[model samples]
Structures are given as C-alpha cells and as structure tokens.
Target: MANVNEPTTNYVILTPEGVLHGFSQVEPSEQQLALQAMLAPEQTMTAHEWVERYSEIWLDMFIEEGWVEVVDKAIIAPHVQLDDFLRYVSASLSGSRRVAIGSDEGFCLAKMGFTQQEADTLCVAAADFFDFLKRQQQRGWAVHGHAISFFSTIDMLMPNTSFIFLWINNQGYWIIIEDEPLLNNRAFVELVWGIKATGERFNLLAEQVLDKKAQLESDQQAQAEEQKK
Candidate 1:
C-alpha cells in the first residue's frame, strides 16, 4: 500500500502483479465487504480490517511529529481583501494551532501559521517563487496573487484571489490554493475548532453560509409578494 501521508484520487491501485487498496471499519457495511472481497479475492479482508492495518502502518512510519497541520476548506463565498487575509494570517501564525489555507481552486495549503518575521522571510522567498512561475509560464503556468488579474506577478495582490501555489513551512502540512477559500474569520474559525474539539463532523463551512444565503433569498421573495397585496 502507498503511504497514508500521501492521498490520491484513486483509492485503488491495480498492478499486474497485485491489487492494492486501503480498508477501514469507519465504513463497515455488507456492501463494503462485498466490494473488498471482489477486489482482494485471496485475503478478502474487510474494509475496516484494511483501514486498521493501513492506519497502523501509517502511525508506525509517518505519524506527524508535531504542532502544525494545514487543512483544506471549501470556497463558497466571495473572496476577501488582501488586508483582511494578512490579518488572519497574522493571527494564525501568532498562535501554535495548526492552520490551513484552502481554496475553491482545488487544493489546500496546510501548515502552522508563521510569525511576522517568518512572513517577511516568505516575502523574500516570493521573489524566487515569482521567478519560478515565470519559467513555468512557457508551459502555460503563470503567477497570480489574491485577486483576479491579467498580470503575472503579485504585488499588493488582492486577497482571496484564485491561483495555484504551494505554501511550505518546516512542518508536514502544506497548501496548494487552487479553488477554495483560506478561511480566517473568528466565528468560522471557532466553529471549525468546535467541531474538531467535539469530534463532530461537517462538510465545508462555506457551504453552510451558502445555505443561509439561499434561505434569505427565498424569504425576500415571499416578503415582496406580501407588499404587493
């Protein structure tokens, strides 16, 4: 099996020699069992069994050593300004919590937020980063910042801009903001932590906001009809 640290779109891998896939009890059902049996005819291990083995191997080999994790989030709302982005970045970095910057762009950047000095260091690094993007341009790659723009380099670029780039730190988490928002609001952030704290699960936070927006639209239409009457 491939390492757990690396997630791939295709959970199953078929080689002429053998078929490989991970299994876990998190999805314990007869349907899952039948699928597993079909996939691995020899061992016919249950999904839960496979997952347990996979997780055990991961813990033994690649358990993240410490204080940083970059998680992905959904992009379901308008983007924020560059100023607001920096503020959130500042707060995340000042604390020891694991911070992540996700985007609707497709990938997310996860890692421990950096301090002012570290951010400054990244600014210096951005020069080189920009240069790298320039080279990749010939192949259809371009460098963009937080906001949408025809320009290739980022300078006072708008926040919540759409583009793909890798954000790295000394930790295991990294972000590749491609099509999602890097969440940094207090209420939302707290909601995320709250979910994490209670081991509760939910889909992307922005989706909830979108749902509320839809409700508001429906309500407004009803009010308009009453006013006409």
Candidate 2:
C-alpha cells in the first residue's frame, strides 16, 4: 500500500527516431482520492484490481479531455559528411539564431552565424562546463553517469538569449535561441544521431592517419638501422 497522495514520478520516453516525450502526473480528482482511500487498507485487493478499478473512473476522463496525443516525428536525412550534417541541423532548428559543433578539445568544427573567434570561445566554455559537470557527477551530486544536455543563459552572447549545450559522443553542440520556447525533442534527436555518427566517422579517420604516421616513422628508423649494419 503505497501512499496515493505522494507526488507521482515524471517519465521521459525516447522514441526510436530520437524524439523525447515527457509525461507528468495530473492532480488526483475527488473521485480518484476517494477510491484511493477505500483501497488504502484493503490488503486483499491485488495491484491489478486497484489499477483496473481506477482506470474505469479516470481513463475515459483522460481521453475525453485530450490528455494524450501523438507528436509527429521530424524526418532528418542521414548525412555522411560533417559539414552537410551541421548544415541540415541548422536548417531544421529554424528558431535558433546560431548553432555550433565542437570537439571536447575546445575546437569548433562548424558553426552558423558565429565568427570563428566567438565560436572557439564558446567551445572552450562548453568544454570547461562539461569538465565541471563530470566532476560533480564523480562527487555524487548527479545520479546519472553523464549529462546529456543542459540549458543556460549566456550574457556573453546576448542579454535575453538562451544557450543549449548537448554532450554527445565526446562532442559539444551549442544552440543559441531566443528566450521563447526551447527546441523540442523531435529536432533534438536529429542532432544526437548526427553528432554521434560524424564524431565516430572522424575519429576513425584520425586513428587511421595516426596509424599510418607511426608506420612511416617505424620504417624510416628501420632503414637507418640497416644502413649502419
């Protein structure tokens, strides 16, 4: 017998397409409260029985009141090149004033509507913020292992503008938008997948280049040794 008066937990559901939907519990109605009271001490009533009984009183009400509805997914085509992906993401986030992608090392890879200096500065700030967040997580302040996204007000950029920072696959994504309604999960999913894919692709390329360079160095050293022999 759990306390029915306790606050219900909030739920976040992520669809396959990368859209995130949040559901919050509504306040219990008089009838629902009465039903909870009646069932409070009823040890014989199974969990299923309680749920079934409550559904009869509240399910129809929720449906009639339009409490739930489907959200259409934003279709984003897959992009192989990082430039193409960033361009597409910028267009999709039409409400945003500026968007930038950068590495964990504080180097801006691509940006829209931001000077190179500004973007680089922002990327460095984001890297510092991410390091702070990781330290907090290590200190037991954050229950999750890592932070996915966060919002902040950036006075450095604009007085009333909002900054959204997303951490995906060791890449930092910055979105600057007006202080209105923030970007929804539908568009968010695209950035998540896009960043992940491009990050992995470039990382692989970097690894290959490093491997080739190491091989060349090894061969040059071997040649010098043979000449001495």
Task: Write the residue-wise lDDT of candidate 2 on 40-99 in tens digits.
Answer: 221223323434665544534433443322223223334545555556656555445466
TM-score versus the correct structure, for each prediction: 0.26, 0.45
Task: Assess each prediction's global lDDT (C-alpha) against the native.
Answer: 0.33, 0.48
Candidate 1 structure quality by residue, lDDT tens digits, 9-44: 322211111111111222334432322232332222
lDDT of 2 at 74: 24
> Candidate 1: which stretches are off by over 4 Å?
1-115, 137-203
Clashes of 1: 24
Query: What are the candidates' C-alpha RMSDs?
Result: 17.1, 17.0
How high a TM-score does candidate 2 get? 0.45
Residue 67 displacement in candidate 1 (angstroms): 23
